[model samples]
Target: MDTLLSIFDVKLAIENLPFVLSGLPMTIAVAFLSMGVGALLGLFLALGRGSSYRLLRWPTRIYISFMRGTPILVFLYVLYLGLPEVGIELTAFQAAVIGFGLNSAAYIAEINRASLNSIDTGQWEAATTLGIPYWRTLGGIILPQAARIAIPPLTNVFLDLTKATSLAAVITVPEMFQKAQIVSGRSFDSLTMYITVALIYWPLCIVISAFQERLEKRFSRYVNE
Candidate 1:
């Protein structure tokens, strides 16, 4: 009970919240951008991995393997530091978006590939019989179905990305975690400030989880029925 913080302390944590909330817009922008970039690149990577051509397949396989196998923090450093040597200068926040998005793509690609594989072989044959191009068949026939199968894993990846945003503090993106650190360092109320940030994340996670459930139900209803 002694460690329990007071209402004044918690209120102090939020009173000057506008500055912290300003950083929130950047956090949201990074997340949505990450999801968009991640999903598109992941879709192609998944397709390439599933391709019949050795040239197309092997490289993507290696790329996905490397990304998935490595830690994202390591990836972040390489992109932020190593890329600068090659004339790529991303601001810290930009680098975070790119790194987290790329990391997410690797996992999402695997999820998509697995979902695509789960479809009956006959669906491909049927699409071919209808004179649909292979790519069209994939887009119109397969991907929507694959999307349903991919939802749970995709949701999990988004959650991971959301949490992983804390790492932005390392490169100084001034996100929630970084804000907490700044506040704690100033007030010496380390526990109280971090507790507020922790509180913020929990509700966001729950909302995303709830949406994921609704998406799962909507998709399942179509296929299962």
Candidate 2:
């Protein structure tokens, strides 16, 4: 019982609550900013991958492959440490955002591509039959349908991105995990600080997932109609 109880210290965790919570804003900011950057780049890459032109298609494919293939930690190191060797310097926050954003974009691009492909061919046929421009058909009709289809997966990706921000602590970005580390080091209560951090992440993911489910159900109704 002593060993089991020692595994977690609820009292210490509660005591450190305010200190760990202080990092919440920075964590949210990193996640939001990274995902925003990812969405734009991912959308662009998805369009490029779908293009018939070899120039656009080949490079986009290669980029997606490389980004997806590389580990996130390596990419973060490349941004935070490697870039400085090339005469480019960025603060920890900037590096975290850029690194995480670029990594998230590759996954997001694939998600967008799959969603875009899932769209009904008949919709494209009807648009083409009506003499709608390719870009207009894609932007106005196809994308809306794809967006609904993509929401659930995209929300999962966002949740993943939010958790990935913890890796920023490695580069000294002072996110939630970093704060927990600082508090734990000073308090000598690793288990409590870690549990507190996990608690924080658990709820954020739960909320995002709950919202995703609601959106998915709403979109399904549109499909059924």
Predicted candidate 2 versus true structure: per-residue lDDT over 1-225, tens digit per residue: 888678878788888788888889999999999999999999999989988999999999999999999999998899999999999999999999999899899889999999999998899999999999989998888887788889988998999999999999999997899999998899888887888899999998998899898888877764776
- Candidates in order, TM-scores: namely 0.92, 0.93
Off by over 4 Å in 1: 6-8
- Lowest summed lDDT window (length 10), candidate 2: 216-225
Number of backbone collisions per candidate: 0, 0
> For this target, which candidate reaches the highest TM-score against the unseen true structure?
2
Could you tell me which 10 consecutive residues in candidate 1 have the lowest summed lDDT?
Answer: 1-10
Candidate 2 colliding pairs = none
Error of 1 at 173 (Å): 1.2
Residue 37 miss distance in model 2 (angstroms):
1.1
